[model samples]
Target: MHDRGRGHERRPVTQHVVVRWKAGLPRGRDEPWFLMTDLERPARRISEPYARRMSIEELFRDAKTRRNGFALRAVRLKKADRIDRLLPIVTLAYILLVGHVRLARRTWTPGRWCSNNRPNECSDFTIGPALLDQARFKPAAALAAIRKATEEVGEEWG
Candidate 1:
C-alpha cells in the first residue's frame, strides 16, 4: 500500500502480527487485535507492553477528564515556557494522588462514590470518597467507632 503524507513518506512495515482471542461474552465472540511493530522481540513480548499501555492511557484520561483537571487547564496557556513549568507540577500532583489512592484502598472500605451500576466493573480511580472519609476520623478512632457500632448492633466486627 502506498501512503504519502506531508513532509514524509510512510515507512515500510517491519513486523505485523494478528492476535486473536475469544471475548469473554455470553455469545463467545472472537476478538482480533492487529499489531505492527519494529522491535525484534517475539509477538507475545511486544503484545504484553501494548496491552499494558491501556492502563497508562486510562490513567492519563482520568487525570485529564475523569478525576483531576490537569490537562484541561493547559489549553489556556499560549506560551511554551508556561506549559513546561506547569507539566512538572501536574505530574507531581498526579503521582501524589495515585500514592494517596493506593494507601486509601488498603486502609479504607470502598465508598458509595466508588459504586458502579454495571456488574463486575471496577474503577482504578478511588481516592475521592476515601480521602473525604479518612478526613473525618483517625485510623484508631475509626476502628473504635466501628467496634462500638457493631457491638451496639449485636454484631461482631469482622
Candidate 2:
C-alpha cells in the first residue's frame, strides 16, 4: 500500500509498523489513515485473541507485585538471561499451584469467581473454615488428623 502520510508533517516513525487512525475532517467524517506494514496486520490480528486471554493478567500482576514478589530485587548483571532461564520454571510452578488451588478449594477463601484462589494466596498458609471443619472432628488431634485426612485425599483422588 502507498504511504498515506508520505507528505504529511508529523513525528518520524522509523519502525516498519504503522497504525491506522481516523481524525475528524473539516467537511464531514474523516477517512482512516492506514499506515501499518502488511506483516504487522497478521500479527495484530493473531494477538487480539491472545490479548483477550490475558484478562486475568492483573491477578498475576498482583501476585508478582504484592506477595513474595515484593522481595524480588533486580540484579545489576545480565538480567534478561537470568529471567529467560527462570521463566519456564516459574511458569510451571505457577501452573501447578493453580491446579492445586483448583483441587483444594475447601482450604481456600471464596473470591472473584467460580475459579480458584490466585497464586498470591499460595504463600498464605491459613486454612479456611471448611478445612477447619474437616479438621475439627479430630479435636485435640487436630493437626495430625488433618494431615492424615489430606494424605488420604491425595492418595485417593490425587
Estimate the lDDT of model 2.
Answer: 0.42
TM-scores for candidates 1 onward, in order:
0.47, 0.30
Report the Cα lDDT for candidate 1: 0.54
Residue pairs with clashing backbones, model 1: none
The models' CA-based lDDT, in order, is: 0.54, 0.42
Q: Summarize candidate 1's per-residue lDDT along 1-158 as a digit string, tens digits.
A: 34466768885555556463425522333355677655777666667665557657766676677344345544688889988998798766555555454445556565533553332133344453347555444445444544554466464223
Q: Where's the lowest-lDDT run of ten residues in candidate 2?
A: 121-130
| Deviating ranges (above 4 Å) for candidate 1 | 1-47, 66-74, 109-113, 116-158
Cα lDDT tens digits, model 2, 22-114, are 334333434443343434355456344444354355434534553333213342336788878776775554444443444445444545322
Shift in Å, residue 117, candidate 1: 11
Q: Candidate 2's error at 117, in angstroms?
A: 12
